[model samples]
Target: MTPDLADGGAASAAPSPAAAERAARAPLMSVRNVTKVFGRDVVALRGMSLDVRQGDFISLLGPSGCGKSTALRLIAGLSNPTSGRIEWAGGGRTDADLGVVFQEPTLMPWATVAKNVWLPMRLRGKSFASCRADIEDALETVGLKGFEGAYPRELSGGMKMRVSIARAMVTRPKMILMDEPFAALDEITRFKLNNDLLAMRAKLNCTVIFVTHSVFESVFLSDRIVVMAARPGRVIHELNVDEPYPRAEIFRTSAEYAAQCRAASEALNEAMGGAGAGHE
Candidate 1:
């Protein structure tokens, strides 16, 4: 069973000892020296490589125009890398085992939240009645239990994003790929969703590969932050966040967090050009 965090901020559930023991078993998904090039000279990715261990919360972070989204698309099989290969743990190329959330909600306007969340299963040929319990559970997980019957137009921006998350979770995917899933939300809503996402990750035990530009969000949510450089995106730095799960707001205010964020900011600055190029 997953350990639930206590109200006083104690980590009730550290990662399972068995999970720790199997840490090096093999990555659930592996991106091996992947590269993506557009016609003739435009390169999106350049020999990028990373390993996503089972149940890891990995984030791909970089400035605008960096290939963060392209990397995620390559993993999702939505776009093929021009060079290099992405292999699943035991060696496979299909994305049937993954779920993907785009930057936008992309929900069906006519479908109820429940129906929209049920789309993945339905596409897989699963019947609605057969997956009713799973749909309800997913909705509840995203804090949208009572709004399952509501349409997309009736929901607020945050609620719509929750619906998008619920849809991704309903499939019981082995891995989830998120491309700045919360970038469009307001600060308050984004923070709330960030906390909710951490809680959900602890409970679900699924691997996540998220793409974002926010250093603070990357530090708070990732087990490992992969910082990429622009123009033919390549890895410039990889930083491991050693903090425990269910991270608290206090950690956000601590010196350690600031230091790491500063390090990331520096790397990102250098990647963009130099220290004085952009506003940190």
Candidate 2:
């Protein structure tokens, strides 16, 4: 059972450095010294490295143009790195093993929520009759059980986003990569989605790499935040959020949360300030 976050303790408790060392034991994917360049110049990323452990939620946090999305794209194998490597543990994992959620819902205007969610399964040659239960389960997981017949235009912004998420989850991928999926929503909706996201992640036990510019969101969601810098993007700091799962409102308002947010904010500021550059 998932631990109750409402009965909070030190949700942002500081773990020993060795804690990460322990988590690193079952590394799922590693992005090592990867770089990406466009045209003659336009370096999007440089020497970027990150380790994704199984069942961990990691956030790539940074300012705009910091290559957060670029990193996600590289991990999704949508693009090639200019240098370095991306390694997946126990190898031979294909695109079928991944779920991707972009900033926009990107739903089909002509399709129902169920159809949109069914797209992934259908692409894998799964007929509606074959995976109908899985699509419904994914929708229910995202709190949209009764809205399967609804069109994207008929749903609220938050609901549309939920459909997008439902689509991603339908495939039951080993890992999910999200690029600010909730950035477009209002605070209340975003908060609700954040909680639901934790619950879903707990239930799915899938590893996640989320990219966002919101420090608070990153602190609340991530086991570790990979803070990055721009102008040839690279990781500058890594801050661990030792908080427990099912993070509740009490945890959010707690002093521990504030402290973690401050630490992340400071790290982000320093990253934006260019603590170390001169690469690429």
Candidate 3:
């Protein structure tokens, strides 16, 4: 089972035993000295590397054009690194093992929420009749239990994004990649979804790699935060959130959360200021 949330505020300020244990286990995937270059001019990522362990909630935290999304795309096999390799723990695998959610909902406008959630399974050759239960379950998990029949146009912005997340979860993927999915939502909606996402993740026990520019969001949601530099993006710092699962509003308001966010902010600022030097 995933570890429970820390009882004391300070307990979350540093890496916990549970986080260390998880990190020591075999990684689900590793990006080793990866580089993504466009033509001969644009270099998106430079020698970027990270290990995503099972059940980890990792946030690729950085400013715009910091290669956060590029790294995520590489992990999803949506794009290949111009140099270096992305390796799976089990040696080799197919893209089917991943569920990717872009910044936009990108739902089918004409389809019901249920059908939208069912698309992944449907593409995998499962009929709607067969995956009906899974479709409902994914929707319900994202707090859209009674909105299965609602059309995308009928739902609010947050609700539509929830549908997108539900669709990603419908496949029971081993890992999920989210590229700033909540960045466009209002604060209230974002907070609600942040809490909801933790619950959903606990149920699935899947690794999550999220890209974001928000320090608070990254601190609240990630077990590990990898801060990146721009202009040939690379990791400049890595901080362990160490916070427990099922994080509630209280955790968000706690001093521990603030401290972590401050630390993350400082690291990000340092990354932003430094020149894109060689990655050690």
Candidate 4:
């Protein structure tokens, strides 16, 4: 359940020292001048750059051809950038350090939910029996406690997506990349998942880079929204929601949310017009 925030922010008068310290620290990851070009004439992304700090919920909000997924794939190391680089504050990246959830649930049809969630660990030579407790805990966290033995076909679209999220989170990576994980669900389900996702992030303190086509979803879920342009896709503007997390339905209906939506909408319009890509 979402906790009621009295003022919609500031559970207390003064910010905690931990909060201040987190704010002061450097970004956890930096994408510097990254551009992705597919064969001869296709350019999926160009000169894209952004910083991802720990505990951030950033949404890459853009249109059809804006390369949002391409950016995510690049960050996940599924594809290499044509130019520029992605740098981690600590060191180089390894498969174990990142988690990725695509728009599709992408669970194995023949496998049980627990088996699917255990795949990552199993790939690292950990036996399914050995990871049973971790798998059950992840399923419980995602509200799928007793459905472990169920298969994907037995679950609803939303439930399947929850299983997908559980699989991504079971490893407890420092960062998670979601490429429209909730886009296929119905509005009611999406809203429910949105709330659950924030709650999960709060519990895990994981950095999230989300890609979304909906301005409302972006504004509702993100601490920062990066608006992108097409025609060799790139970022044109970035807007900070600057709102506190664990935000409830009340925040969705608040005047502040409305204003933020308007700003994001306007930015989207400009991006579609091919506004010059902006810089930090």
Best-performing candidate as measured by lDDT: 4
Candidate 3 backbone overlaps, count: 0
Using alpha carbons, what is the TM-score of model 2?
A: 0.90
Q: Please provide, for model 1 over 1-280, each residue's C-alpha lDDT reduced to its tens digit, 9 standing for 90 to 100.
A: 1111111012113464433543654578778889999899989889998888887888888988789988998888888989898888776744357887878898999999999998999998999999999999999999999997899999999999989988888887888889999999999999999999888877887889999999999988886778888876888777666576779778889876877677667666767767666534
Off-target runs (Cα >4 Å) in candidate 3 are 1-15, 274-280
Put down candidate 2 lDDT per residue, 1-280, tens digits, no spaces.
1132211223334455635553665778989999999887999999988888888788998888889999999999999999999999998578578999999999999999999999988887889989889998999999999998899999999999999988888888999999999999999999999999998998898999999999999988987788888887888777777766768877889887997887777677766773434323
TM-score of 4: 0.89
TM-score of 1: 0.89
Backbone clash numbers for all candidates listed? 0, 0, 0, 0
lDDT score for candidate 4 against the true structure: 0.86
For every model shown, what is its TM-score relative to the native structure?
A: 0.89, 0.90, 0.91, 0.89
Clashing pairs in 1: none
Q: Order candidates by lDDT, high to low.
A: 4, 3, 2, 1
Candidate 4 per-residue lDDT over residues 1-280, each given as its tens digit: 1122221232223555534654675678999999999997799999999988877888999988899999999899889999999999889887777888889999999999999999999999999889999999999999999998999999999999999999999999989999999989999999999999988888988999999999999999987789898887999877777557679989999887987787787778777762433421
lDDT by residue (tens digit), candidate 3, 21-116: 765866798999999998897999999988888888999998888899989988888888999999998877665688988899999999999989
Which pairs clash in the backbone of model 4? none
* Residue 106, model 2, lDDT: 96
- Cα lDDT of all candidates, in order? 0.81, 0.84, 0.85, 0.86
